[model samples]
Target: MPTGTILVADDDAAIRTVLNQALSRAGYTVRLTSNATTLWRWVSSGDGDLVITDVVMPDENIFDVLPRIRKMRPDLPVVVMSAQNTFMTAIRASEKGAYEYLPKPFDLKELTTIVGRAMSEPKGRPASPAEETNEHIPLVGRSPAMQEIYRVLARLMQTDLTVMISGESGTGKELVAKALHDYGKRRNGPFVAINMAAIPRDLIEAELFGHEKGAFTGAQARSSGRFEQADGGTLFLDEIGDMPMEAQTRLLRVLQQGEYTTVGGRTPIKTDVRIIAATNKDLSHLIQQGLFREDLFYRLNVVPIRLPALRERLEDIGDLVRHFFMLAEQEGLPSKQIDQAALERLRRHRWPGNVRELENLIRRLAALYPQDVITTSLIDQELSQPAPSSLNGEDASQNLGDSVERYLNGYFDNFGEALPPPGLYHRILREVEYPLISAALAATRGNQIRAAELLGVNRNTLRKKVKDLDIQVIRSSR
Candidate 1:
């Protein structure tokens, strides 16, 4: 006897035959149809043990008939298959009470496994109504890599699971976080994002958990932190690996107990926020180096999602370039079009800064080049120029003092009213001293007297400073 009867619907005869053969070989009776009308007739009459339907049918859309099927047969399970594999499609399938969603060209073995699981599992509750929105697509790309990400994100939207996104800088970690929050059940709630790397080490806790009026010397008034602001929503902790060890401990406690206290308050406040943390660093390495807490790493890495770099998904470069071009035109930049050769050139690049770097290059091309068409030579010319962060030889164009001042300005901007860590002068000087002495030594070919003269310091003082900074000396030929 057959294990169960499976209802299969699709407009394509080839797909129907394939699924029919696969299901029949697996010891199940399969009923095949090409239109939604026939599929719904069988479903309404409770003729099949399970329903497998395509998103688009010749007679009607499966999504349009899905709610009626659910209302008529709440116990029946439906697996949705789609050729239009997008984030929105996956989300809609899930929202319409799909047992599972399979993108086109899926493996036969995986389909069988999913079918088995769906048949054995108990029936689920009817899906909640989907939220309405008219925002632009947050993520773009139809490569296999992006399709897999969309599937995972779709499954995660209904729950409050803590997601840990790991990727290189500029690979759109925060964008993924925002997509999750924007499409999730908490869409009505606010999304609070804080970059641990941007904030000072000592102030990280206060920034996350708020502070009492008299929390510390500089606390003139009570303040609410990110957790309070994100209550009933998502709290996105970007650059989570940069969080100090002390703050990590407190964050772990909050994750464990679902509550937190102000910096100087004794009363614990309950939290109803979903935690989504992201990092560009290797937390495992940090844990091994004693810079991060292992317990905290485990707490944050509940559902880890690693985003692929641009080079890994080079097939999507053309789409991304077009998207960026559209954005640039919307922002009042000159309209520009890239030729095939120019796009191929982009695909060949390593894209060390990933998507953000590509967007900036497109913007630069639109602004600098007056021509409507962007060619290979123009792309090559723009790419050959040194990146903003690239440091040239010893005599780099940017002055050391000016660079330090700019870094301090950014650091101070991270904290609005709070002061930076104590011993600012010593800390800043110590940071600058090592590099200054090292460069001077390298320039003078490790000669103590000449290096001292170049730095306008005494030879003995240079030796003492080198010893204190642990500089390794290499003497060149005389």
Candidate 2:
């Protein structure tokens, strides 16, 4: 006797044969069919322990039949296979209540394991109505890396799991967050995003948890924070690694108690908002450095999704380029097409700034180039120019000064007519010194001597500063 009767459906005879053989070899009896009609008959008659069906079939659409199958036999698990392999496809499979979704060219062993699990596991809830999507897709690319991300995001859309997205800057972390909110159960709710790095450190709490009138000198009226504003939706905390330690403590409390109070309000407001945080920095490293709270990290990292950098998914560069081109045209830029050679050239270069960098380059090409078609030579010329960071040596310094100026202005603004506390010089210097020294040490591969030289300070002074600041240094081979 076989372990179970498995029904396999695919338009391709070769695929049906492959699945039939694979399942048979795994000690299960397999029934093969090339159309959805036979598969539905088997499912409706309760003749099969499990059903594996392709999305596209000759006579019937699988997605259309899946909900009916679920209605007739709610306990029968249906595994969906698709060659389309887009994010929308994965979402549809999930929304239609697939036991598991396998993209084409999947590993045979993985399918077998899914089959075993699906047969043994208890029955799941019936399929929910599929959510409608607009024309705009927040994420693109069908690369294997992106497919995995899509599968994870699809599963997460129906739940309120707190997700932490870790990736390098400009890797579309915000886009991922927005997608989760737009397609999730909270689709009808608002999505409020706040950049931790953009706000002054002292004001972070007020920005997140709101403030009452007369809470501070700047509070002329009551203000609702991101959390209160997000109410039944999602609160996206961008650059979460840049959050001050004090705010992390407060955030942890909110996550723990599911409620929070404003800056001067005594009444605790219940919070029903979902949290989705993104960070380019390593939270583990920051935790070790005592910069990030470990407890808060655990709270927000319940469902962690690490986005792949552009270099890791070069296969999707062509798709991403075309997407940007379409977006540019929609924005009133001249229609432009990139030749195959130019696209290949783009794939060869290291995209240090990731997708955002590519998007900017595409927009620039569409705006600046006169030709309707872009060539490899033009691509080379655009890429040869120094990156925005390297365009001017003073850019970094100017940005740093501007950030400091903005913070000071906010600080003064908060005080109204009053001056900030005494010892302002030392306080500000210490704040600047820590990151500057840490960055220098990181740049020098933790070589104290090299860091000291780079900072134009004595080695002894650098060592003492490192000790005082508790900056961990792991020296690398010179």
Candidate 3:
């Protein structure tokens, strides 16, 4: 059999030489590119059948290279490599449809095996799990992305640092936080959760700092704040981005001084809490916008962990589906096996919501779409509607999105593997328009003025979208 050709791309000269020798010794023709520019040129020029690329190549956003590579050869296999190996980069590769993701320090045998198998196929095959109709969330696949997430979790088990998990709303930020806490030394402590956005602004300080018997009105009795409640435990601050500036400042003090006092109490109380704050917001962006404090950002994000969005880490779908399968069974649901077509559809989806979304979908499938094999039709019907929040604390509107994004970017230096879909402007408009229109209509009870304040959008703009999306508001007799 003729040796298949391998294209290796990275900015490092030494890596390229080593890879060339390694691949050459393993019985393959090796070609090289120093950066994405040269790499793109070679791929565009129809250079080789199998491409291996470093994500952070000079002069290129490899994240953007996926579509172009597919455009050139839709079936040509390509493997992405990265040193940073962040959730965003892995997820980006998945979104852009890479054949496989290989994080740095990879074993030689694995690379050879992947390339040999890819070249043999004569068409690209994404490194998705082996197809089965089983409805279990198994955390499947050996993809580097999944491995890296596991690696991070393992490392976090050793540290007591305040972790900040970031990802999209459905990307499983809470799970990451839980995994760290459970695997870490604080496994036995109470895991107290407080969603900053869910609570009213005025009460947040009181909730976090605790209040004296008569600190403020309605202070009927003394109550412990999350800090005190979570003494010697893990305090998960979900949607921490929505924390008021005043609260943020105080939290920063607690983090810095390792203590806090009740709202009205002058005596300082020491805290032995491990914080694992999560958000989807761009805290840096918020900082630039003067909404999020820089000091607090650094304090909360001592150790950042990024969770992969469902679409960003599509390779893990099989494992996730399998995991969800066992999940449904445990919850007393009938068998919810997903067939090949359904799995493919799950693979193709944009999954605006991440793993949490997928988990919810799986549970719903198990509960509602019982046995006889889950199909693409089922998944399509599910995706057609707006995804609801899991556990139903608060609907993951823009605020939830903000927190997930913050946690994701905090750990994963480079962002998602997949670029946002085409028509981002339209998608954003719809995102803004639906809520704005719905809120206005709801607040007004179909009246225009009341709806506008609830949405903070001018009635005229709301009217324009109502016209554009054909959203009808029923006339109220009020």
Candidate 4:
């Protein structure tokens, strides 16, 4: 049984009553208030062992009062509750020294657990708040899925943990990375991003760890690598699954030793940049295929954040659509409103391109359409137009050559003037084989012979692939 007093402040009488009941039942003496003023009085008088307050209050915003309370009673754990549930709300709660930030409509049992945990733990001074910024919203959507992400991101904003973000393309991996860097401890440092898929395999090492002049045939001048440039900041390795084995080894060494040697240079340079890698591909599958290094995967998988696909969170489509419209307006595009029916229609979409696809649709609606309010008909026409096939080569309506050519065109477009690094054939083959073989194995349920037959390959060749790919085989026990 708990023995300390728990002070809770909320503007709503129902909330106060409910919390009072819950905490009292949990064996704590509960003091409830409908305003921050009374809560401050209780805290200033040192009357409570724990504090639960909402972000908004009748007399004052709790954010303004939290710092004063922290200074006066550093040991009192303050848990923040809010109905807003936006990314900023969670971050503000963390920055204001809240022990935990629970969104409104949170589970009562979860709240009690958090309170109990706070009470049992030894009280200590909270982390000092980082420099404040009134930057534009870096993320949008208040769906339950997004709320969970916001909570995780808030907790991570103050740490230097290496994060691995995996999601479908256009799912805002880069935005999440930027949010981490923009609001994190290293906000002041530069955020450098490198796309492994976009860069040639041979050039990846040099691109990441800059080359010394005269080291290679084309070496002209000593160049700083992303590690050197992002020293004290973050290095976002986009499409990390596409990184070659040799480069993966070098990256693993850097991660292990906290130092790297510039290509064609001897002295080891120490670096202090946080690593945040993102990939749309299935890295585990890649690992099984012996493409990605298992050691490197473990190093970067320290804090994995798998973003939910757009189709998985259809509830957020409305919010995302509105956010994109607002952005379009800010960029001198005409203002647009999407009808509820249109939003519902959007929810039904498979959204193969994810948020990026939705954003493009919204942008086009704002730019091309003459109407102020968008209707289901407009959405119908847009969605009806043949969406360029997914790069995964899933749509069989197009010929293989056409699909490969389209994908290659886009891949080449990523580099404006310069051509992609050499050795494109092996890369393309690996990309195609990865999905094809995985599909065969999945359909056959890890039966090598069946998979080989399905793929029309010899059993021995399939066995070698299974070994070389390190693919995990789970036999069905039926």
TM-score of each: 0.80, 0.81, 0.56, 0.81
Model 2 CA lDDT for position 125: 54
* lDDT (10s digit) by residue, model 4, range 340-438: 999999999999878877887887677555578999998998788653333344455366668668757865674567664445565456446655666
- Model 4, position 296, has a per-residue lDDT of 94
Which residue pairs of candidate 4 clash? 288-469, 289-469
* C-alpha lDDT of residue 291 in model 3: 78
Local distance difference test scores for all models: 0.83, 0.84, 0.71, 0.84
Off by over 4 Å in 4: 388-478
- Model 2 lDDT tens row, 296-331: 999999999999999999999988998999997887
Ranking by lDDT: 2, 4, 1, 3
Best candidate, lDDT: 2
Error of 4 at 360 (Å): 0.5
- Candidate 3 versus truth, CA RMSD in Å, comes to 18.7
Count clashing residue pairs per candidate: 0, 0, 38, 2
| Stretches > 4 Å off in candidate 2 | 124-126, 388-478
TM-score of 2: 0.81
Alpha-carbon deviation at 214 in model 2, angstroms:
1.4
Report how far residue 210 has shifted in candidate 1, in Å.
1.0
TM-score for candidate 4, please give it.
0.81
